[model samples]
Target: MNLSRPLDSAGGTDDSLGGSLAFGVVKSERQRVGVLAVLIVLLIAALLWSVFGPVVMQPELREKVRASLPFGIGMLTVMFLYECTSFGWLTQLIRKGYEPVYWVRVVNAVIEPLFFTAVLAFLIVFVGPLNGMAGPAPYIYFPYLALSALSLSLRLSLVSGITAAIGFNVAAFFAVHGLEATPSTAVLVSFPHYGMKGILIVLTGLAAGYVGHRLRKQLGESLKVARERDRAVSIFGQHVSPSVADRLLHQSVELTGEERQVCVMFVDIRDFSNLAAAKLPGEIVEYLNQLFGPMIQVVNDHGGIVNKFLGDGFMAVFGAPSEDLKLARNAVACAREILSSTDRLVAAGEIPPTRLGIGLHVGVAITGNVGSEQRKEYTVIGDTVNVAARIEQATKQFRAQLLVSDAVAEQCGPDVAGAVDLGLVELKGQPKPVHLYQLV
Candidate 1:
């Protein structure tokens, strides 16, 4: 799920979390561009208010504020245009799945605060140095500094904050130097006041950066968890009941090897080789598909899963994982349903006339993921599994469509107790004969 893009060298992407943070960066830049436009509109509105509305001030002070307006507006206009173009470029890169570069963000962060400094410079040129050193011009830096947090990047936030502090202090210091000859200017040019203000701006930048970084980190982790959950469901859900699949994935059921009592069912198509021998491969495949499709649904409906296909037949297990105590009864019900379903298929002429052999057994078996790391399988492997297969084979000798070991019959009691006893049958490779019962 790590979606890495090759835009890092171009400085157009964030590859730190495998390009996960790139989209957020681009989205933040687009928002910053909109902020610039709003700031310009507000500046123009202030200019209009100053020009047309009744504003009381000394003629020199009024001219000073008016003089700073054009300079401030022009600088903002240039910055806005630059930001709009940069946002467009980042948008283009993102559409192509490239990582957006950081240089544009880096440049914008450092340069944007200096626009207010330019307004301060114009104030020094047109008015007494007091307005430049201790006035409203430095306040403009705070808005953009606050916006740096929207980038979800601590570095960019800090850069914007630091630039604002440096630019404001430099402009204020120059204004103080201009008042050197004035004896009254001594009280007005306070270094500690300006220095304390600069420190607070830098601290604000640091705090904003920390918040942005934390937000970005949380987003990355949440995306990872969701993707991993989807992957598990996609890969493992096919072979199990949906309920079982959910429990296994959510850690309620373990996939690792463990001993659990289960009811195992093995189903085999009778004389399938002879039936397939005369037909074309495709024809035979279609025939098998028709028979098996509904049979699989029957298994799933009975709290079971067709764990794996064994060529002409498949092995299904009831209880799905190991949580159901009713596995024996469910497996018995599923076998009878499969038999009824096949009858309906043949009756409707949906498939060729077919016969089935089903065997059910109940016992402790080792169930878990088996095979190599690259090619693993979830399965049951033990005497219980072997006995189930053997019982399916004996169905031919007994002339029965369904058979169950005494263990399964006993477990299910009344529902399965009526099964006709087939006597102690000596199954192949068994040390002793197993009590078998016929259901068909």
Candidate 2:
């Protein structure tokens, strides 16, 4: 089925295709966001380790490492918990809402300083292997730094702010100790400062675990969103078509500026004027609405867009909005369905035997959105539209219910065996004559 035609032309809705596409986009974006975050963090961590070396222990090295580890560990833990909470929050928000602003984020921000100070301060007081701390000064530095990190994290998303704070703290620590600079030519390397060394090792391992946890949490959340989007789109696609609903959900519009071959079909009820004259206006409208239901089903079943209802007639198109090789086949199928349904209606005495004329033609057309900013419709506009209409008019002269241009017949291949040739005729207002075929 080909569905890339104008919706208003036939007066129908397309939700199936649109919905599927929408869900796909949402899923992809969510996954990409998670993957990108992980990659960026990995890069920053690699750079930090490279510039600062594996471990620092002496008094000089201890001070430098203390400053840097907080930022790294602080960021890692904050982002980890944020992602875990964010997933739950987002899912709840979408389904209903169970209060996203909880204590998790607040606690995450507060914990960085508490954890850093506890570990570093305890090491300074008990072990005293590195340079001796000046009373609470060393301990105060850790909390002060942690609070600063927490404050920075509040402005950005928990993940982004944490990462930035970590990066900033690390750079400042390394800069203050001249770790980023070349080794001092005059001073020789000192012995390992056991307390500083133990603290540094502990912080790095914890930070790594924290970062890994965040990565896992983010990936899990992304996967959930993808699955949900897919499930929703699938269910929604069943109601309308996937195509239209997907577009609406994802908020995407295709504007491909390329001319392409298309199959156009136009149908009109015979003696519509007489029917309207005999019946009340409301009755006529009600009857037309009922008729439109079946017609729309037929058209959409064959992957066509119901463009518009012009008075007593309706227009449909295939191979545009998007294109496919089965455009003409779909149109032909639609015509057959219409004929069969109308015949049943006539036999049941619901209305007079419908004298329908379906025009089919294949040609190049400018297929896209048409109309001004306030009122735009997706449709094709070109000579092909005119030719299809004329072929419709020719159905009367040919004594056939369906008239197709030679262009359409060629595309139909063996299925066109039952069609009869209609000699080339000069259509009204046409510069060139067109060859037509009648489907018996």
Candidate 3:
């Protein structure tokens, strides 16, 4: 049996993590929309104030303000429609399990500046000539360009900047050459100044694009590291406690093989062969899942790492990959919890009456990743693991539910003070007799 395969394979750690990341993306998008809505409201209020204040204070300015009102309304309407469409498109892309296109970003980057340029043109051509109040449109390019750099990619920001510059130059040309009724010597004199502003616009775009490029690169690297950490946690977290997994991720503990004192535990389902013979294959698998689920949880909760699963049992270790001073006690506590949980399951009629043989031994073992380059398993090996298995088998002869070597009993302190000693047991394949203890 492949112990690496989780009991609930369909809803493993990877699926849970992926679901969480997707939810985070959705939440972030919703927040962006909310912010955009607030900004739109503020813009509308400002426009209303500007248009109404002039009309009440000076009656002569009413016609000028009214003429600009239609342009303002048109620009705002376009902006609102664009925002709605962009938000809808982004939502649809996420639902379909795809990232939104770069063009969407380009549109968002360019639209605001484009609208601003249109408003400037409206003022110069319609409002300015009527009221004789326009000189040069306020430099909307710099502020909008800065916003684009922060929120967009290098290419998108640069393209938006260039587009704004071109639009401004076109409107300025039409204002000076096409709209003026009397050709003035002053227009030619200011031509060089306007040309310098155009050059500055292009330079600003390049600088902002470079900053955007660097920011995007940094953000990508940060996200990559976060994803790697998440993947490591999801994979390692299955076999070990979360704290152990975290330590492994942060390199706080060495993963390479090392000799350490470990408490190895072996748990076997007694008479499992008979149970399998009496039921269908699917039923046997379901029963095993029901049996192992809580058992694994108990081991994890007690700070024991489940190393591997045998055909009808599993091996767990306390103090591998990371060290614990009370490994023997934790192993014993985990075994007791498993037994208690099994009794409850039987009483609830979730499974037939069942018995488990649990064994524990504390000794020096080599712990590390073991297996081929293509596949590896983190586990423990040495005489300690072998002794633990032998102790588990001796439970059948002694008619006991739990057995542990003298070393484990001694290390467990007062927790096993009431344990009964089964002395001088001759274990198979061992020349020396080993002292054993049984939990009543």
- Give the C-alpha miss distance for residue 46 in model 2, angstroms: 11
lDDT of 3 by residue, 216-239 (tens): 566656656787887888787776
Runs in model 3 deviating more than 4 A are: 1-144, 153-189, 206-256
Q: What is the lDDT of residue 403 in candidate 1?
A: 97
Stretches off by above 4 angstroms in model 2 are 1-113, 125-260, 297-303, 341-353, 365-382, 422-434
Q: List the residue pairs that clash in candidate 1.
A: 11-101, 12-99, 12-100, 12-101, 13-99, 13-100
List pairs with backbone clashes in candidate 3. none
RMSD of 1: 9.7
Which model is ahead, 1 or 2, in terms of TM-score? 1
In angstroms, the error of model 1 at 220 is 1.9
Worst 10 contiguous positions by lDDT, candidate 1: 1-10
Q: What's the true lDDT of residue 59 in model 1?
A: 78
Position 118, candidate 3: lDDT: 79
Clashes of each: 6, 29, 0
Report every candidate's CA lDDT. Answer: 0.77, 0.57, 0.73
lDDT of 1 by residue, 291-322 (tens): 88999899888878888789999998875465
Candidate 2 lowest-lDDT run of ten: 185-194
Model 3 whole-model lDDT (C-alpha atoms): 0.73
Q: TM-score order of candidates, best first?
A: 3, 1, 2
Tell me the TM-score of model 3.
0.61
